[model samples]
Structures are given as C-alpha cells and as structure tokens.
Target chain A: MVTLKQIRNSVLIALWMMILTFPIMVIKVNTIENIVIWRWMNLLYIGVGTVILSIFWFFLINRRKLEPEERKRSFALKGKIETLKGVLAKPVVQKPLYAALLVIIIIFPFVSSLYQTGIMITALMYVILGLGLNIVVGLGGLLHLGYAAFYAVGAYTYALLHRYLGLSFWVCLPIGALSAMLLGILVGLPVLRLRGDYLAIVTLAFGEIVRILLENLSQYTGGPAGISGIPRPSFFGIKMSLSTAMNYTYFLTFALVLFTIFVVRRLEHSRLGRSWVAMREDEVASEAMGIDITRAKLSSFALGALWAGLAGVFFSAKTTFVNPASFTLWESVIILCVVVLGGIGSIKGVVLGAIVIILLPEYLRAFSQYRMLFFGLILVMMMIFRPGGFIPAKRRVYTFDKAQLEESD
Target chain B: MAAILDASQVTMDFGGLRAVNNADVHIDQGEIVALIGPNGAGKTTFFNVITGVYKPTTGDVRITAPGKETESITGLKPNKITEKGLARTFQNIRLFQNMTVLENVMIGRHCRMKAGIAGAVFRDRKTREEEEQVVADSYAILKKIGLETFVNELAKNLPYGAQRRLEIARAMATEPFLLLLDEPAAGMNPHETRELDEMILKIRATEKISILLIEHDMSLVMSISDRIYVMDYGLLIAEGQPKEVRANPAVIKAYLGEEFNA
Candidate 1:
C-alpha cells in the first residue's frame, strides 16, 4: 500500500509537470480566425496522465527503498543486463551483427525514397564529423566546443576554389582537407597548453572568429549571402540530373564512411592510439612512459581536422552551396552531441547517434514547431539516464596462453 | 662503475620557497640506491627535476649511458628524458584506468616503436609486425611481474599490489637504463612489500637496469638498498653505504630521529 506521503509526492510531481507542459500542449493558435485558444481538454489529459505515471513511479521507488527484496531484485536485473552485454560482445555474435549492419547500409539507398537518401547522406556527413571529433574529445580527452570551424574551413575551401579557380571536386578534396589540417595546427599550437574547459572556450572563440571572418570578408567569401551555384561532382564526365545526383552523393558519402571506419579502426589498435589512451588517462604518467605530449596533442588536432575537411567538401558538393550560417556554433554542438550520445569512443555508437539525432527530428516534422523542444527534452533525459551513451565503447582485451608465449619465444 | 645518472648542485625554487636546494645525487650502473627522508623532504621534487618535469634553477643533470659520453639532459622535456633511457614510476600509482593491463604496457613501448599516422592507419606489414612484437614483449613483462593472469583486465580493476607492479612493468617496457621509483611501497602490505623487494632485485639482475627509489619504509630500505642518501629541508644530509647511513648522526637527527640512534 502507498503511504500518505507517497500520494502527496505523486500529486506534487503531477502538478509540476502540468505547469511545465501547459504552455506547449494546452495553448493553441487559430490562424484562420487569427485568435488564441486555450485547449482545456489537453490540460486535463496531461494532468491525468502525469498523475498516473507519477503514482506508478512512486510505488516503484518506494518499494525498493522499503524492501531489501526489491533492492535485491533490482541488483539481479542489473547483473542480467551485464551478462547480456557480455554475451552480445562475444565474437560469435558480433561478427554476424557486423555483417548484417554492413548489408543493411549497402542496400539502404536502393530501398529508401530519394528524400530519405538525402537524409542518409546528411547523417553520414555528421558520422564522419563525429568520428573526427571523437579522436580529439573522446580519445585525447580534449573538450572542443568549436569543431564546426574546421568543417567551415573545409566547405569554404571547396567553395572558393571552385568559384575562383574552377577546380574540380576530385582535385579540391585533398586541398580542402589540407587547408583544415593547417588551420588545426595553427589553432592547436597556441592553445595546446590549456586543458579541459579552458581549451574548450579557446576553441569556441576560434570557431566564432572563423565564422565572423567568413561573414565580413564579403569580397572573398560572399559574406552572409553565401556562395551559390557551386557545381556538383560529376561521374567520369556524366552530366547528372536531380535523381542521379542524389544517388551519386549517397554512394560517394557511403564510400567515405567505409574508409573512415577502416582508418579509425586501425588507428584505435595502433601504437599511436595506445599513447592517446594513456595521455587521456593520465598526462603526467603518459609523459613519464615516453609519450611526447606535444607531438600527440598536435597530431590529434591535425588528424581530427582532416576528416572534418573531407566532410566539409562533401557538404558543399551535396548542397551545391556554401554559407557562413551553415557552419555555426549550433552545428558544432549537434556533432558533439552525436559523438557523446552515441558513445564517445565507439565508432558504431557515433554512427548510431548521428542517424538517431538527424533522423528523429526529421520524423518528428508533424510537430514541426515543437520538434526542437522535444529534441532538447529527449537529450536532457538521455544525459540524465544514460550519460555513457546509448552504446558505450567496449574496452579492448588480450588473452594469451602459457603455451603461446613459449612458442613465440 | 660508471655513474648512470649524475645530478650536481640541482636547485628548484617556487617563488620564495626553495623546494630542492643544492641537491647532488648519483646512481651507479647496476646499483640499487635509495633516497630516504622525512615527509616534505623534497625527494619527489628532486625526482621530477631529474626526470625533466621541471627545469632546475641552477646546475645540470648529466646521464652517461654504458660506454657513451655524459650528456647534460637538463631542461629537456619529460618524454625526451625518458627516451634518453631514464624512466620512472609515480609514488601514487598512475595506471591508464580504462585501458587493459597489456595496453598500458604497450603504451610504455610507444617510444621504442616507430609508427606514424600513415603507418598506423594503413597497417603496413612492418607496422603489423612491430605491433605484434610490442604485444608479445608486454605480455612477457607481465608474466615476469606475475600479472599475466590479469593481462586482459582493466588497469583500474587490478588489485592494489598488482597495480603497483603494473606501473613498474610499464616503466620497464620503456627500456630505461635507470628506473626511478617514487615511494613504490607507500600503501603496500608487508607481503606486497616483500614481493616488491624481490621483484626489484629480479629486475636489476635480469633487465640490468639500475634503480633509484625514494622510500619511507625503513626496513625495506635497510635490507635492499646498496647505498642510501638522506635528505632534509631540500638538502642532502648524509650519503654512505647502508650501514654508514644507519649510523650517521646527521641522518639520525634529521630523518631517522634521536630515538632510532638509541
């Protein structure tokens, strides 16, 4: 039986939720009549629903608090979840799962509509950006708040090159990436000594400076009006229409994503990768273990920017336009959220995060006005409940038998 | 015997306070030296100075490798100093908590191995072979340290004693000619301390690496150290063979205290 205090608490929670949801749900606009209307029925529905949900939660929480048996049951549930995770992580299960995912991704464009294909391209672009940022933030333990600046550098590099010099997309790809890398080095050199929040603020300021320069340099960058009529990449001199253009961009991005996965996977197991992990865990100990902090920090910045540059090239080619507004602080925050919400260091997690964050808002278009609010609410809830992400990165393990060591010797 | 590490007249001042003042210390090839003093004696500060964590305000630290010329390594970066064949373990165990035990050791092999971004990303045959070697060598070190059983476990998950051993194993993987240990037995039980003593001896014998440890445990210091240096107020008070250091009045008054002499 629920106590008097439990009932009161549930009621208070219901009242609080009502106050919060009233503005969005109960308030409505009659555009045709040009009048504001208070939808009382909606308020009643929310109040009733909240009261029921709160009472259920109170019972669940109070039972665990009052009974050792309930607490034990919860512990058992957690143990089962851990066991399930272990079982899923085994090679026998993982190999098949990976194969299935590969097959699904390969066939996605063919099965989906043209609009969906466009969305997939956008998601893949964020995936590349997320993976790049993961190296600096997740692996190197650097907080970068202005990562979108590199993306801008990549996009603008392609836009300006094509507009002035008439450079082809294939020719400009590497050049764009190189420019970003150089900028990364330039920015990293001055701020490599700062750690944690200080580094983040500096990077944020750097990002803003890049955007403002792009805006004010109207003669060179086209300023706030942005550059238009940027040409789409052609397939071996084949002129493309709208439908074929969508497919072309999809395949291009797909190939890039696969290459990214391969590079990131190899780097994760390499000597350099291990050094990054060490530096992230403990900088002082890492230095004592002979990791050159300066080299490692600089390399992380350069390499992370490399992928962003590539993605930026694709973003321009896909849209056939470049704008200062496209590369904003919000863009950086979203990409960061994709990295963190998926699983910071996990490639699969980042991919999943990019897809979810990108696609969920698109699907919630029926609630167009409230989509961002809903997205914000979901993100806050995800942070509160699963801070490690939807899929946390797995730790690497090595096992060797005594006989193996002897044989190697 | 050649002096592997020779820090002469080293001084470090933070504002008005002198942390390490006119400190001179040296470790001979294959010798096990101990630096002992009371709390706040600047033993760690001296270790940091030698390891290139801090540039000394005055004086130079010279390292002479076997059959090589003595090189003044003062003001070099810590990693550069480590690459010059001097490595150290922290007084507080600092393992890469999230990484596996083998990975921790593999990181120590970082300076020895040469693989840039291109090699790491592309996985050339040579890079692959080098990585395999690193793994094999790290596993071998773990076996010697008796932590092979926990090789796959996260560094944070290891027992306190094993974490301490892992730190040593990591330092050894750097292929240092001289290993500086900062209070390695700080939180160890008697049994763990004894195991550490034996391990240190084994490392010295097998790896041929000289050891310079700052230890507060008197019994362990007395039993294992070939030579002892006593420090107080950032200055070396006495230096001699263990017996002489034990009997020295200056060391007794400053570190061991009057009761120990009695």
Candidate 2:
C-alpha cells in the first residue's frame, strides 16, 4: 500500500529542500533571472510541474500494470504487508512482535502530547544519528568509535555560526554538515592504515582530542558552558517557538527522520554500499579485485560524518541551547550500541534499536537511579541471546542454471 | 621457444639466513614446469619472490608476452604484476570465504570491470551488461573446472578438492598468460592428484596459459611436468625433463638419502 502521508511529507520536504538550495541555484542561473519577475519563478514553476507529471506518470503506469497477483507479488517483494501478515498469522505465542509494534505506534502520539516533547525530540535525533553511524560501523565494518566527534563539530558549527555571524539556523545546517564531513575525512585518512581493534583505538583517541580541543578553545567554542539560546527552525515567516509553534519542532524532526531514511535506503542498495560490504568481508580480496580500498573507506567516513552533522544541526536547533555535556563520548557509545543492537547493517534493525535503546530507558525511569542497572542488563542479555539483532541478512542458496548444467553434462 | 618468465640470480635473505640464495630459472611459453623440493627448501619462497609478494634481495624477473617486449616484474605489487599477464593461486587456498564462488571469480576480473563508481552504484545499462558478461565468464570458468554447481556456494563451504579447483578457476578468471600454482596438490588424495594432473594438462592445452607449479607429490610431478627443477638447501641441485632429473645423482641424493644410494 502506498503511504499518502509519506508522499505528502515528501512534497513538504521537497519545497523546503528547494528553498535551502536557492542560494546555489541563484548563483548558477546568472543572466537568466529577474530575481522574482520571470526568471527564477519560471524555473521553479517548470521544475515543480515536471516533478508532479513524472510522479503522476509513474503511479498511473504502475496502477495500470498491476493485477491482483502482480500486486501481491510486488507487495510481497517490497512492502511490510507480507511481513505484518506473516507475524499475525503465527501462533498466539509467536505474535508478540505484531502486538508490540502496534502498542508503540499507538503510544507514541499520546506520549508526545502528555510528556515533555524534549525527550521524544531527542530520541528522534538519535534515530538519525544511529542510522548514520550504522553506515560506517555496521555496513563498512570500520568500527568508528569517534562518531560523536563529528556530531560535536556539527553542533559547534551551527551554534558558533548563529551566535557570532548571525547566520540563520537554516543557513548553518549545511555548513555544519560540510564541516563535519571534512573532519570525518581528516580522521578517516590517518586511521585507514590501521585495522580492526587498532582502528577502533585510533578513532577513540580522535574523539577524545576533539572533545579536549572544544574544552580548551574557550574563545571560540565557549569552553564548558557552551552556546545558548540558539534559534529554532522556521516555516516561512513563522518561528518554531514554545507558546505558538511547539508542534513545528516535532514536524521538523519527523521531516529529518524521513529524509535520513530515504537517502540511507538509496545508499544501501548502491554500488558504493556493495563495495563497503566487500571491503568489510575481506580487505585483501577487495583490493586484489581492483577496488581502491582507501577511496571506499574515506567515502564511508565522509557520508557517516555528514549524517551526524545534519543530525547535530537539527539537535542544536531543537534544544535552542548547546553544551559540551550534550556531546559527550558516552553519547557516541550510546549511538554505537544502537547500531550494533539493531543488527549492524539492517536499516530496520538500526531504527528499532535506536527506538528501544532510547525509549526503553525512558520508560523505566520509574526505577530512577536504578535505570542504568536495568539498561546495562538488557544490553548484555540482548547481546547474548539475539546477537544477530532483530533482523539479519539472509544467506542465499546457489544453484546451477539449466543450460550450464547441460554443458557440464 | 620464447621464454615467458625469466628469473636471474633471485636471492631472498631473512635476517642472517638466506632463504633463496641466487636462484636462476626461465619458463618457456605454454610449458608446464614444476619446482620440486623437500619442506622449507625455499620453493614457495622462490614463488613469492617471482610473484612480487616478496622483493628479491638481488634479481631481475621479467615476463616476455606476445607482441609485448619483456617487462620487469621485480618490485611490482602482486595485483600490478597480475595486470602484466601473470597471476597466482596460494598454497593455503586463499579464496574469499564469505564471498560466493562466483564473486570470488568475478573479483579476478576486477581489473576488467570498466564501470566507474557512478555506473556501479546506479547499475546503469552498460555496467549491468558488463556485470552480466563477467558472471557469464565466471560461470564458464566454473563449468570448465567442474564447479558450475558450486558457483553460488560460499568459498569456505566447498569440499577440500573443490576448494583447490575453485582457486584454479579464480586464478584463470584473471586471464593470465602465465599462471603460478603453489602446492596445488598439497592436501589432495591420490585419486584427486591424478584428476588434477588431467585438469592441468587440459588447462594448458585449452587455455594456452603457461603453468609454473610447486608440487610435493613426486609421482604427479614426474608425470605432468615437461621439465622439473629439484632444490635442496635453497639451491637448485638438478634441472631437466622428468626422466632425466628423476635419475640425476644429486636429485636422488636429495630425495632418497646417501645411505639408500650406497
């Protein structure tokens, strides 16, 4: 089943995305614009029209071609419908997963309304961060223990730019992301020479250095107290403030979550993704096969940092305040746990892991100071019992094709 | 006959010990040659030196290919050496265990993959077509080596004999003009050894790829090798055709003991 909600969200996001890109577009469209008279407006109009027509054509074609059987097959191949049906069709004893997801979805909206939106917003931000780390640690097998360093760079970037330069939050987001990505490559290059546990140690060291630098650079980074009263994301002429625009923060968070998922999903199926996996499985063999190991490793690091930076920018905007405490090494460890707990390379697993690792501890807050005890125990138990996490990639069975069999005979 | 591979005074020293002391050998085009010796006599070391896994302390290793002049292979990286019409299989069966047998073979054709990152990522029509061709070529190699059925199996899961054959299939995937097989029959049973002999002959005849093999099995070596070099104490003691080398006094001393000869 197609999700109208997702499509509608995509449209909203696409418009906001185009707005963010306006500066570059304006610069590139030199001599062809009257600012607002006919040049830029005509391009936007034509682009939107083309996008709508293409989407319409695709939906119409698929609709026409899909028979009941074909529809079922396509859904079976790509959708969650079959998975949901499979879960529900199981014995009552085995149907806990179906009931559990239902409960969470139902509870999420109600909980967001009742409790502080801060916790929920924070959780959503981590979901994006965890997914980003998953691309490196889970898929690439690089074991990047310093992912939080990139997060710090992003938050610090947005915080400093908005505070000093008076640049809008929207403007700082991409700049922060770019800064984080460049730093990611910088860290990735030196550590690429190391392998496995060594690589982890080097990254861990890198993270500490970044934290120490921020703490020491009082003039630039605001030392320990950190930057405060940072602006929130705005919609048109309206600001996402507490009294009138609280819901806008949640909307912006959700939009980011959706966008992160879209890009990551595309990346997972791409050639670069396959190369990352190949490198992870066997580096010697990967290099022997003509893959430039250095290039693949650097790209993973860059993309992973880019994700953290984007998440950090959103996080600082959402909080309207930033401190060193918010970007601690423990935060990096927590993000790492989410990716591993989710089953490394599995996208759904990472999302589920981020939700559970974050929200589960919050739910057990009644236990108070003992919450840490329960969280640690749950993590240990999960590692021991379901090491593959909630989902694992299936191993395919190889069989000979008929013509080849005939030739062999 | 033109020499496909020429090694002059190849020496490898490990600390104070000379592992390979000034060994010189030449391999003719389309010939099946064997380097035979007792354990730790530096046959494998010589293979390593010639294949660019180890740089010889002092030597020149050159390969003369058709329409191409003799090129120095010494000091080149293994993959770079492979691109220069030379490839090798490992003694311990270094197949990428987690990758499929087909993928392991496809990796050998990695240098041949013309698709760039963009093409590979998007699976563009040209890349897709190229990938299909690679798969076909890999499948064909597998079929020739009696491993077509195991094409999709993980390399680690194959039986001992098939794993050895898979290594050969993988090496062939690189389309090497000169193939090096390091202890190809190291762990094989007698029946498997006989089959490998037939397989190697077939490969030489059909593929037209020269074979430089290191084998411990004397019977297999004597039967299949066009010429054999016998080494003892990191020095070449004998070199000639199977019958000539097998009967040589030094080879007999190296093999059977002086007590047996007396």
Candidate 3:
C-alpha cells in the first residue's frame, strides 16, 4: 500500500538529490559561444529517476527486507538453498550430481576458452585461501590479519628455492607449506596471550613486517623487482603447452579444493575442531574444560597457514612470478572478505564466496570501474540486512545410528 | 576417607586487597561439600585459586585423582589442573553459546582424548572409534542429567535451569574425581533446584565423584551438603557438618547481623 505520505516522502528525497546535483548535472556553460544554458530536461530526468528509485527502495524493495518476517526466516540464504540442500543431501541426488559436476569441470577447458579455465583456476586458488582463512577467522575465532604473511612465506619458499637451489614445484609444495606452518607456530607462540583487538593489531603488524622484509631484503628476495620466469608445475616430466599447463593447474587446484573441503570438514567434526569451537566460544570455559588452549590455538594457526601456504605456492606457480607488490595488506583483506562474505565457518559458503568475490569481477570487466563501488555496496547491504553472509555455518549435530543396550562398566 | 582435593593456606592478594586470606578447604572421597558466604566472601576467589584459574599468592592446591597420589596443582594452568581431575564451572554460566549441548559436554573429554592434527585430518579407525565413544559418553551424560532433549540445541538456547544443569553435565564429562560447581543452582526455581539436588546426589552415587559447590541458596546447601564451610570478609568463619555449621554462632552471625548475635 503506497500511501500519499510515502509518495510525498519519496518526492522530498528526490528533490533533495536533485538540488544536491543541480550545479554539475543541471547547469551547462558554453564560454566560447558566449552562451549559458540550463539543462531542464536533465533536471527532470534526475527528479523522475530519484523519485522512482526512492519509491522502489523505501516501499517495494526495502519493505520486504528489514521487516518482521526476517527473524522467522533467520540469517538463511533463503528457501532456494534450504530446498537445494534437501535435494542435494540425499545420496541418490548428490553422488551423480558430484560426478556430473566433476566431469564438467574436467572437460571445461576443452569446451570453453582457455581464459575462462585460467580464471577458474584463480577462483579455485582463492577457494583454498578462503577455506584457510575460514579456519582461523571462522572456526578458531582467531582474527588473523597477517594470514598472507604465510602465503608470502609459501610463495617465497618456492620462488627462492627455485631461484637458488632450482627445486621443482612438486618438491617445493610440502616444503612451502611446512615453512608456513613453522612460521604459524612461531607466530602463534608470542601472540597466544593476546585476544580480540590486540591479536588483530599484532597479526596486522606481522603482515606488514613480512612485506617490509621482502621489500628491503632486495639481495635475497629480489626486493620490489621480485623473481620472475618461474616455471609451471609439470606432470611426470611431460612437456605441455601454456594452454595445457593452465588446464592442468585448474585440475590440480580443483582436486586440492576438494581435498581442503574434505580435510576441513573432517576436522570440523573431530575432537580438535570441537575444542577449537569451544576455544572460540569461551576461552576461560574451554580452559576449565581441560583443553590445552595453547596447543589448540597453535594447531589452528598451523593448519590455517598450511592451507594459505598451499594456496600461495599454487599462486606463485600459476602466475610464474613472485613479487612484494603481489602480496600486500590488501591481499590479506581480500581473503578475509571472502570468508566473511561467505558465512564464516561454512565450507560451501566460503567456496561460493571465493567464486563470487573472484570470478564475477573478472567477467564484469565492462563495469570494472564500478567493481569496488559494487563491492562496497554489496558488503554494506550484506552487513546491514543479512549479516550472516550467503550461507551461515551450522553447528555440527550428532545422531546415533542405533540405540545402545550393552551397558556393564 | 581419602581427601580427593586439598587446598591449604590459600591466600590471594589482589594488589592492596587480600581477596582470600589463609583459607583452607578439603573435600574427601564421595563427599558433598558446600561453601557458603555473603556476597563479598571471596568464595569464588578461593574456588578460582583451588581450580588454578588464579594461583594463590601464599598457598598451594593439591588433588589426588583416583589410583593416583596427591600432587600439587598450584602454579599449573587451569587445563593442567583439570587434567589432574579437578574441574570447575564458572559462577556466571560460561557455556560455549554457539556449540551444541553435546559438543559442550564432548569438550570435557579433551584431556582424555589423545588425537592430534594428523588424527583429525586423516581420521584413522582408532580416532574414529574414540570420537564415537566420546559422542556416546557425552550423550549418556546428557541423558542422565535430563538434557537429552536439548542435546543438539545450542548452549545459549537452553533455559536458565537447563543451562545450569548443562554446566554440571560438562564438568562431569571431564570425569573429575572432584567436581567444583560454582553456583550451579543460582537462578533455578525450587523445582529445578530440587532436580539439581537429586542430580548431584545421583552423580555422587553412580560416578563416585566427590562434589564441592559454591552456592548462595542456603536451603539447598543445608539440605544436601554432608559438610559446610562458611566465609565472611574473606575469612573462614566456620566449618563443620551441616548441623554443626548451622548452629555455629559465627555462621548465624554471618547470615544474620552482629546485633542479632549480641
């Protein structure tokens, strides 16, 4: 029901907007011709557009959004996802669906442009990074702003090893991850006592410190120039074209994303995961519950860093270069956004978050100028209306397969 | 009877103030001990000192797990103390709000379970079996405590009484030889308090776990505690069996006013 008052309010907002833009949008000066013209039609368009938009926003769109129905609906991604999960959770649907999805992804490079596959590989890499950040920020409840420090560590390990010792990507992968894990443990040790705001500050400092070190240590890390001409990972000493290599990286990244999902999912349901959630929930209570919080926290940091490290190596391999410019505070922020834009602690949410945050922007190159504007708008709208991100992570629910009758202790 | 938990001359001085001064508390095998006091009595500080949340400024706490010798738990972290069979709940109900009721209990089994990062990721048969057993054990505890219905519910979503009961269930999951419950019945109604009483008694009978509780509910404390300790102004005013503690002049004076005693 659009009342007269609503229409008046909408018109008043439109008038305010038109007045704000009157100088630039409505008035034109032609000094050379010695003529001044008022673009009354432009003003009319502004008035009509603002009124329509405001009416649509206040009455039509926003009314459905901040209304009383939301709580009953909750922070849900909505009925489509709920219905999708119902349809998808069943083995009859899921198994074949998974197989079909895999087949399509495997054959995607053949059917689609190499550029699309490359973009997908980038997206999948972020999926891995998003899942990694999800562990620290999402599950462990550690706000790690220096997460990319480990990514830098991973990238540097592979790059420097290749540049100096000439180690292969396959050999450098685990070493790169281990180097990050070691750094994670090292980082976790000093920051163990800190919590909340202090922790965020410390981790942020850690990230900057790593970047500065890489920049300043020009002799070792090639300073800002960075190491270039790094080779793509090979499959069993076989030579392949750039196109073939891109597809292979895509396949490899896709497989690893699956592995990360499996490992993280299993971890979430396991004892360590429970303790991590417990620690996240209440540190003092978790301590009283007999969790070695120091060990638990360090484990999460190590695991989260390990994934970031894996992503970093994949990144260095994918780009075939290493530079301080590529790794900045912004890199960490982007990964953080992926986890937050996906529901924190939700695996599928993180995956979707990575895809949306990474892939869509690449395809929308025409509106590339407005990408950050759109990003800011979407984030603001998400934070205001649906703060739980696309898909909120659910707590693990347990059920018994059968009733227990055997009892003698 | 063997004393399962003993804290001697525990004085906690916070800067210029002595929150708890030379307070000694001991709980024996299968005994229900109660610590009662006025609001600023340092009962919680004493509890904290004993549970290793705060190390005492002057004294030491010792716990003897079943089949184990008495060992000093002082200077150890709370997790270490809990591993030694002394588990405590917070007075303010510090449950894992987002975690399910069962997971809340399962966390209690942390010290007992030995799975590492590798075990969690790869999930060998042993790890899987241990996890399943933990789930079963945790559910059994919830069932025993009548929180089975809310087993899958988040800890925050449980009602006031159930939250209190869930605290006890979680503490029990640690398999503590001596369970320290800080105000387990604080917000409970008479009916809920009655159930708590029955639950505590049942826990003692079935699990052979000794209990020490800090409560302001005088009737419940008087009715259930085999022994009682009273504190006032951070001093141990009196300690005895419930009858003796009830009639003690200091206990009465602490509860009533100085004028009433006069």
Q: Who wins the TM-score comparison?
A: 3
Instruction: Report every candidate's CA lDDT.
Output: 0.90, 0.80, 0.89
Estimated TM-score per prediction?
0.92, 0.76, 0.93
Cα miss at B57, model 1 (Å)? 0.5
- Model 1 error, position B138 (Å): 0.4
Candidate 1 residue pairs in clash (backbone atoms < 3 Å): none
Share of the reference A-B contacts seen in candidate 3: 0.87
Give the alpha carbon lDDT tens digit for every residue of B64-158 in model 1.
98778899999999999999999999998989999999899889999999999889988999998998888899988888888888888999999
Candidate 3, residue A71: Cα displacement in angstroms equals 9.6
**Model 2, span B17-105: residue lDDT tens:** 89898888999988899999888999989988887778898889998986688889899876677777777888887777766788777
Cα DockQ of the candidate 2 complex: 0.16
Off by over 4 Å in 1: A1-8, A15-48, A54-100, A401-403, B256-262
- Residue lDDT tens for model 3, B1-262: 4578888898999999999989888888989999999998999988888878888899878777788887888889999888888888889999999999989999998889998878998899999999988888988888888888887899999999989888988998898889998998888899988888898899999999899999999889999999999999889999999899988988888888776344
TM-score of model 1 relative to the true fold? 0.92
| Candidate 3, pairs of clashing residues | none
lDDT for A337 (candidate 1):
97
Candidate 3: stretches off by over 4 Å: A1-85, A405-409, B260-262
What are the runs in model 2 whose C-alpha is more than 4 Å off? A1-111, A114-121, A168-171, A241-274, A395-409, B260-262
What does chain B score (TM) in every candidate?
Answer: 0.97, 0.96, 0.97
How large a fraction of the reference contact set does each model reproduce?
Answer: 0.90, 0.25, 0.87
